[model samples]
Target: MPHGFPIYPWLCLLFTYIRGLNSTVGESRMKSLLLKPRSCSRVLQGHPWVFAGEVQDLLPGSENGKTVVLRDSRKRILGSGVYNQNSKIIWRRYAWNKVPFSMQFIRKSIEKAIQRRPVETCRRLVWSESDLLPGLVVDQYGDALVVQALTLAIDMRLPAIATILQELTNAKAVVFRNDASVRKLEGLETYVGTFNDQVLEPLNLDIDGLSYQLDLLKGQKTGFYLDQREQHALVSTFAKGGAVLDAFCNQGAFALQCAKAGAKSVIGIDSSDTAVQLARYNAKENRLEATFEVENVFDYFTNNRDERFDLIVLDPPPFARSHAQVEGALKGYKEINLRAIKALNPGGILATYTCSQAFSMEVFEDLVSGAASDARRTIQILHHCYQAKDHPILLTMPESAYLHGLILEAD
Candidate 1:
């Protein structure tokens, strides 16, 4: 029997073993590996974002807006996401489950987001990653859909998303205001145009009993700050019988609300002459007693130090673009809040907000507190406000909670 043994059998066994070993090694190499452990911690901690530094080894070089699989060190699959090496957020996780990222996924996400709120005449249809579709936001204004593509990943998928919006909402037109500065971070150019059909004029919106005319083409953030709708209603409750000053007032949202709430007088100030004219027109359309001024908010505060008001709103744009600019932003916040606090009469109300994501809630509160202390005034917290329900914040991503407002009383 030993004599019948052949060398060919031994060679075959060796080849089979080597092949098996090679396959095992190849599979190990195929596992998605995050380069940085800290990045893995963030993802494992339920955050949906992964920075470029977090990846230990991306199997393939970062391709712009290409879907890639995510895996852990143990050779386990984590999820699927889009890769954008140019962005600080290199990976935007779309789903935790094994689902193909497709138009169907986007449509379902949009539908689910829309269902979260009661049927409103106007609302946000898609809130970026909050809806599990990162870098895309769609606001519904009656028959029109205003879209903002803020990232390369979303911009690449804009056509599919836009088609879904038009088909689902039966929108007369879809307008792409791809003018957000964040796009530049993803190496994308700015663009503004109408999709499907031309939006010839501003669209009229009736929101929470008040009517608003929006210039989808020329206006900011899809023609209005729909996220501030609830805050506007809250301010109206305290605006009655007072002289209200709306600084940085665009289109008279706060001013019109105050006037409609029976405020004795309303003064809206903005640096843009066009904005001032539009605000004045809005007040006139609503039959409200409101005045508009084309002056910079900071300049107005500097020139009129002795002016006093019963109620003042300081809703400024985001002062910080990155974490490094937070200190300068804080200084700016302190300056404006200090002036606004000093301008308020005794027992007056100050409705203030910071739309900066870099400015955390604690930092914003400290800034407000410091302003009150500098003005030698006592401040009482009335209420804390956030973006409306239409702009849903994802629990997994705390960064999505960008808007913060505080109603404070000065004594």
Candidate 2:
């Protein structure tokens, strides 16, 4: 309209702006992946992971932390995912369509994940791929939120995640517990940090009427095992007037709950001196009468042959982290179950759990059966437990359901 000023110069400027816009769009377009014939079957079945072997071709510039649109060999659209050339899991699907990897997407995903779980003082907000945000886990403890970024894509977006979480939850602090060994599988280095330059300290939280001091900075798996929150109360229901033993007890959650439930006696054992000391401190903080000892559970069982308990809880860390270690993990599970069965009084209860994703429930149950057979004890399955509701399991991905437990009665 300003023809008098300079019509030719204005037209030239408009053309240049259009070219720049097109260039930006081209640069931002998502890279794509073509999958092998049968590889698409798993993606079609709703699984979210695609290994390197499954990928037929990857577009140029499809590097780690880049989002890719996945397609089957037949050119059919499969989904969109984050590409990681450095990881065996080359692709982690986040949506069934081409989705932009942006702050809005991350914020919406986190919001939806939070909405899925019930409001609680402590709970898992985002559970890795189960919540459609692969390799990202967010756990809330009171006013603090602990996050873990296991994949390169998610790790790169940590600042965005922290900002979104802070905005949504109004949390006092957001701490990163990215020190899990599993991060190595994704080629991520381990380090811990906090959002907003806040200091990481031991947080005192009262969960289910039990007090706990959590060291989110240097503690185990985001300070506490929140996945077993439901199991704590469930196991405590059988503790009244009974002798209780919590093997591999970290911070004495189960033992403290058992003692609070009026158990005749409660003893918690762990190989970590720091854990035992913290457990003792937790017990004293709660004014609960329980014993904490720094000793290997296997050694405790072997040395205290005369010690029998009415209820025993075996919640050990994963003995198997990969498929190669499953056989050894099974043997370890069998030995623990067999020992617990032998150590139980007649009609006593045994609650055992395996956090290893490699061990399926069928495999776990079979091992427990073998243990009972070896111990020559009649075993009755009381309850089959899983991770708490907040840590939901995606039906299609078995790995999402890592924590599996079975309560039994041995006679």
Candidate 3:
């Protein structure tokens, strides 16, 4: 050989090359995907959420609420998500892109949602994953902002989100109503606190030229039902000069609107003594003469057959919590609607709603039809209402569309 050790070295080099190639192939095949050792393929296949059981293996040292890269079992990148070590939903994917998950992203998402709406006065600025930001919901009531962080990922990102909200909207106050029961499912404790430098008090808002007070710290769902703003206005359009009955009226949202719309009289009923008192206060605040009674709506309607109304509203709370409870919930819905239809005078209007996602549109319609049959009355469906546009729904995820109401004419 011209060069000493050439043949031996060449053989060794070839052997090493073959060994390395084999090793690389094997490693590629065996590489574990996902932040943890679990089934992440489902999420990769199109599901937006990754449950704790689906994690294949946690990256050597991923902390709770850490932003992490998601991958499939083949080590192929899936997307990016925020990891919650203690939660059953281990990851809430924010984007499919590899872009940095920063405060700017949050700000942009909020801004996009707000910009989509024609009216900026009062609206839902962020709707969790519907806005591509999972577990984060932000509602705007005039200058006030109400936020609910439902996941550990969102909980950890709360400060960033708050800063973005303050900067983007110039919100006077940002109230954190993190008291939803869903937090417990995430293994996080419930908390209600305020973020940013803003006052915590009942703030007055102008909705369709009517003044309404919202108690950010003490009210329901950020002190008012902002999602019902459009529906309230719609109800007011047809309420003039009628005797209205608003069952399960919370803070007089519908009842007060009916009164302001020139309803001759309005009677609001709720089981909670506190809600009844608040409804009365709201009526007085609006300078509207309305009656509020603290009584179980079911009991009140079951016993009082002599009373009738030109219009009746049955916007009750959700009765079903899961799919298994849908049947019973339908019964409750039918019962209430039957009573409402029976109480409606000739040519009266019946506005009914079911906030339960478990109650499908078909089932709710069937319930209304059955109730009309039981009441021995003919009803014409005048309008069907859904959750406001600010609460956007993903076409792929039907569960996001929950609130449903119907306006029926009983004759």
Candidate 4:
């Protein structure tokens, strides 16, 4: 007062108050979702998928591919996630607690995921929800990285992912293999792109002392069946000094492994001509005596019913891509297993696998039992295998355990 200067002028104080009020309103209106009664229980259990039925309300201005807070019916914060109105999975939960989706968090997640697997060779570095980064998968082969962003939020942040991946690993290249059919459910168009260096055709890789060359641009899911590495070796243990048949051999991985293990004869059947060609080339490249044929596996086994093979491997593609396809998928699965059982010599081994997320181990095992009964053969389960160690599964999210296998000896 003595200096004729007011520390807090009336007009200045009014403006400050109004600014604070606007911020509060803006935050509340950013985006928020309320859950129906008992709907937040799944989130409480740490399942990352939030189905549309669980949601009671979406606040105005809730945009697709935007971050939103999830609250229970009691108006208590549960978590936050990337939301999309078009998807049945309204929210792909990224966190269970009130944590900001900041760049620091993203960096730490990517780093931690990379450390989960041995990076000396090809391995899945980031496995979507299993690694706490939902809708994003990154598989590493040497210095090259294959990335798939299944959700728009993750897709939009591909640049960020590429940066973190490249800076951390000094990656020579990053390929976006976004051609998976699952992207359609997220309203995303499929396309392939390389972020840095050009992808080499017939890119060669060494897995368990076996060499495989693949085209990253056109090859199957990240250019190879990396999840079945352990299964390939396990099937080889049964193929030693015996005849081998590998059905739906995408790249002749199993057949080649059997040939390397000194099988009497190895044959690989695949519907894709490109895959057959690749298989033949691999067998030739490694100087292994193995045969590759292009044919529908079901028709081949059904039409050729002679029981001669000592070991048969059925590593089919996903028959049940979605929940609606589960019924038909079960039938298809049973048909193939029955065919293998009927075509096996006495005491022959059958290595069967299903990569469908909808097919649980319980249903798959029951189908196998029914198929064995239909074949009128006595079968004994020898080993049950899962995806390779690199593809870790989340306990709370059973869907993360996508690959299931059972090796059976038949009489």
Number of the predicted model whose lDDT against the real structure is largest: 2
Which consecutive 10 residues in model 1 have the weakest lDDT in total? 21-30
Locate the minimum summed-lDDT window of 10 residues in model 3: 22-31
Give lDDT per model, in order: 0.79, 0.86, 0.76, 0.81
Model 2 error, position 5 (Å): 55
* Residue-by-residue lDDT tens digits, candidate 3, 138-201: 8888887888988765665666677678888888778888788888887666666676334476
Candidate 3, residue 361: how far the Cα is off, in Å: 1.5
Instruction: Write model 2 residue lDDT over 6-113, tens digit each, in one string.
Output: 345335534533433212122258777888876644777888888888878655543667678888888887888888887888888988887766666777888899
Model 4 error, position 189 (Å)? 1.4
lDDT of 4 by residue, 259-301 (tens): 9999999989999999999999999989999999999999898
Candidate 1 error regions (>4 Å): 1-33, 37-41, 59-62, 197-199
Q: Model 2 TM-score?
A: 0.92
TM-score of 3: 0.83
Off by over 4 Å in 4: 1-30, 59-62, 196-199
Candidate 3 Cα outliers beyond 4 Å, as residue runs: 1-47, 52-63, 68-78, 196-199
Candidate 4 has what TM-score?
Answer: 0.90
Q: How far is candidate 4 from the true structure (C-alpha RMSD, Å)?
A: 10.5
